[model samples]
Target: MEKNSQAVFPNHQHSRGKAWRWTLWSVLLAAAVLIGVLQILVARAGPILKGRVVETLKTRFDSKVELDRLQVSILQGLNVTGGGLRIYPPDDVMAAGAKAPLISVDAFEFHAGLLGLVFKPMHVGAVHVRGLAIHIPPRKMRQQGAAKPRHLGKVKIEVDEIVCDDSQLVIGTDKPDKDPKLFELKHIVLRDVGPNAPWPYDAVLTNAVPKGDIHAAGSFGPWNTESPGDSSVMGDYRFDHADLNTIKGIGGILHSTGHFEGQLDRIAVQGTADVPDFSLDTANHPMYLKTEFSAVVDGTSGDTYLQPVQARLGESDFTCSGAVVNVKGKGHIIDLDVDVPAARIQDFLQLSVKTEPAVMSGVITTKTKLHIRPGPESVTQKLSLKGGFVLKRIHFTNPEVEDKVDMLSLRAEGNPKDAKPGAPDVHSLMTGQFEMSGGKLNFSNLNYTLPGASVALAGVYSLDGQQFEFTGKVRTQAKLSQMVASKWKSLLLKPVDPFFHKDGAGAVIPVKISGTKSAPKFGLNLGGKKPDQASR
Candidate 1:
C-alpha cells in the first residue's frame, strides 16, 4: 500500500503540475486573444468614431468639417491626435470649390473620457492645439433679419483647458480695398471654457502686433446660438511696455490699460489711453498724450461716436464730441465740433510757426465746425471751416512788427457798464470772424485797437504758401495826426496827402501790407490796386 501510495502521489503530483501549466498557458492564450480582439475593435472603431465626431462637429457648428488623419492611443487613456483639421463656412455661404476656410489647424491632441461617451455630459481633458489660423472678414452691413449664429447651438463642449501653441489671425476689409492687419499669438492658454462653465475665463497670450504679453480675464457667452446679437462679452486687459511701432501710424513705446464692457453687436467702450512718450508720423515732437473717452462704435458701419471726450496733448486741453464715420475708407467723414477755449499757441510753435521767445503771448479761442470730404485723389479739396477767433491781451514784440507799433499791447475794449464793480477788466487783443475756404483764410471783420492807432483789416491769406494779402486803414493818434497835417504840404507827403487828409478823427492812411510771413512790405495803395498785384 505504501509503494502504491508513493507512486500514485508522484503521478498525481505530476498530473496536477501539468494541469496547472496547461491552465496557465490557456489563460495566457485567452488574454492574448482578448488583446488582439481589442486591437481589432479599436482599429475598426477608430475610423467610424472619427467619422462620427467629424459629422457631429459639422452638425453642431453649422460648418463643413474635414480631418486628414485621426489617431488613437488606447494605452494612453484614449488619447486622440487629429491632424490637419479644417472648418469651412456653411454650404450656403461657400461656393463650390472655394478655398477660403474659417478655421484650420495643423495638429491637435486631447484625451477624451470614455465615461462621457455613455454619460449625460461630456467632459474633455486638456486639448493642445498647434498651428491654428483664423481669418476675420471686415464687417458688412447686413439687413435686420440677416444675423448669423456665433457658436454651436444644441451641442455643449466642455474643455478643462485649451492651449494654443502657434496661432495667426488676419483681419481684412472688402470695400475700398486696404491692406489687412495680421496678428500672431504664441503660447495662448485658456481655461474653463464651456457652455455651463462660468463666463469668466483666464487667458494668457503674447500678441506680436503691439508686441506685448497680454494677461486678461473676460466673460464671454454661453452663446445664444439662435441670436448671436443677444450675446454679450466684457474684458479687462492690460499690457505694459508695449512697442507701438508695430502698429500703423504710431511709433513709440507705451503702456496700455483699459476695460471694455459691452455687447458684441453694438459696441461701446469707456477707457483712457496714457502715453508717456508718444510720437506719430504726422507729428514733429514726441509728446505725452492722455485721453479719456466714452464712445459708441458701430460694428458693421465702422462709424464711431465720441461724446464727452476729454483729451490732453502736451499742455493743451481739448473736449471734442462728434463722430468719425467710415474711417480710412473712400467715404471717410470727420464731423467733429472742436472747442479750444484756451490753447497756448506757443506750445505748438514747432507744428506751425518758428518764433523767438515771447513773440506771441496769450491764449487763442477757436470754435469751429469741421466738414471734410475726399477730394481728387484724396487731396482734401473741400476742406472748409467756419469759426470765430478771439485773442485776449496779445502782446507783440517782433523786430519788424515793433517798428510800426513798438511794444504794443492791445485788446478789445469792454464796455464799462458790463463790468462788475471793482472787478478786473476783460480785454481781447483781436476779435474776428474767420473762415477757411478754397485753401485760404479770410478774416472779413477784424479789429485791432491800440493806444496810438486803431487798425481795421480785411484780407485773405493762403495757408499753404503763408502769403499775406491785406488792405487796411491805419488811423494815427491825435498828436501824430496834427504833426502829419502840418507836414502835409511837405515834399515827401505831397504824393499821398489825400490818403491821410480825408479821414475823420485822425490821419487815416490806406496801407497795403503784402509779403511772406517772415518779410512783409508796407506801402500806400494810392491807386487802389489789388493787394496781390501790388505785392509784386
Candidate 2:
C-alpha cells in the first residue's frame, strides 16, 4: 500500500509538469504568430503608404508626383523615410515655357505608433523635411479653372508638427526676360497640419533684394491647386537689419514691422519703416528717415504699388504715391509722385547735396515726379526729377550773399545810401520750374522777387554747389541816374538812363550770375550768353 501511494504522487507531479509545458508552448506559438502578422503588416504598409503619399499629393495639387524611394520600418514604432520627392504642375495649368517643378524635397521622415497607424486619421508625431523648395508660377500665365477638392479616401494623415530647417520659395514673373524673385528660408515650422485646414506657421527667411532677415508668423490656406496665386494668406512680419546698400545707389540699415492679408497675387500691407542712418551714396550724409505706408503687393511678380506713403526726413514731411516694379534687366524701378505742402528747403539740400551746410534756408513747396532707375550708378546719377517749386522767405545761408542781395534791393529802390556795407539782410521769393538729372538742376522761368526789383532767369546749378550759370533781366523801379549817390555821377548817368529803360520800367538791366554758391559773381550782361558760351 505504501509503494502504490508514492507512485500516484509521482504520476500527479508528472501530469502537472506536462500541463505547464503545454501552456508554455501555446503562448510561444501565439507570440510568434503575432510577430509574423506585424511583420507582414509592416511590409504591406510600406508599399501602400508610398502609393498613398504619391496619390495624395497628385490629387491635392492636381500635378504629377514622383517618389524615388520610400522605406518603412517598425523598430520601436512605425517609421517612414522618403527621398527625392517632386511635384510638377499639371499641363493645363502650367505656363508656356515653364518646366520647373512646383515642389521638390530631398528627403522627409516621420514616425507613428502602431495604435496611431491603425486609426482613421493617422497621427504623426512630427515630420522633418530637408531641402524643401516651392516654386510658384506667375499669375498672368496661370490658366483659370475650378480647383478639385482633396480627399484621402478611408485613411487620412494629421501631423502634430512639420519642421524644415532650410527651404526656398521662388516666385516667377510673367515677363520671360525678368528674373524670378527668390526667398531663402532659414527655418520653418508648421503646427497642426491637416487636410483642407489653415496651417499655423512660423518662418524666418531672407529677403533677396534688400538682403534682410524676416521673421513671420501666420496662417496659410490649405492650398489653391488650380491657381496657386489665389491662395489666401495673412501674417504679421518683422524685417530687421535690412541693408539698403544692396541696391547699389542708397545706404541704410532698415527695420520694419507690418501686417498683411489677402491672396498671394494681391496682398494688402500696412507698415512702418525706420532708418536711423539713411543716406544717398552720392551725398554720404546720413539722415533719419521714417515712413508709414499702405501698399498692395503682387507676390507673383514682386511688384508693389503704394496707395500712399507718408514720410519724414529730418524735420520735413512729405507724401508720395507710386509703384516699385521689377524691370527685365534693370531690377526695380521706383516711380513716384511726390508732394510737399510746406517743408524746409535746407532739409532736402542737406540730404541730397554734398555740402556740409545747405546753401539756402527757406520754406519750400513742391510738386514733383521722382524716378529712380536701378543700376550700378550713384543715387545722384540715377535719380531724375521734374518739378515746380516755390520758395518763400528765402535766405542764403552765407551772410555775404544775403548782404549782396540786400545791396541789390537797396540800389534798385534808388536808395544808394543804404546799399553800403552795413545794410540789413533781405528775404526774397523764388519760383521756378526745375528738371533734375545727372546731379544737376536746370531751372526755367525762374522768378526772383525782392521789395523793389524782380528778376526772370534761366539757369543750371550743380548739386555740389560748385557750379552756377544764369542769365536774366532785372527790372527795377528806379531810374539809372537815381541809382547813384553823387550828383555829378547822376548827371553822367542821365544820358544812358534812356538806353537802359524798357518794358514799362524805369530801368531794365541784363544780368548774369556765375561761380560757386560760396562766392557768387553778379555782373551786367550786355551779351546774353552762358558762361560756357562766353568761354568758347
lDDT of 1 at 513: 74
Off by over 4 Å in 2: 1-45, 94-98, 144-155, 176-178, 531-536
What does candidate 1's lDDT look like per residue over 1-536, in tens digits? Answer: 99888878888899999999999999999999989976886776567557755765665556778899888776755677887988765544344223466578899888866444444345686889999886543433111224465455444335678788778655444556344444466666667765544356555557664677866677766643333333565777777778887654456676666676665445677777677776543333466777888888654455678876787767878787888676454545667787878976554342323323434556778788877664332222355778887776664444555444432111112121222333332233677787875656788877776654667777776644457788877665532223332344344645554546545533566677777544656777777765556656
Q: Can you list the residue pairs that collide in candidate 1?
A: 411-428, 412-428
Task: Report, for every candidate in turn, its global Cα lDDT versus the true structure.
Answer: 0.61, 0.84
Assess candidate 2 and give its TM-score to the true structure.
0.89
Against the true structure, whose TM-score is highest?
2
lDDT of 2: 0.84
Residues 44-163 of candidate 2: C-alpha lDDT, one tens digit per residue: 888877877776676566668899999988887888999899998766556455578889999999998877556656678799999998888776556633355544344356678989
lDDT of 1 at 188: 60
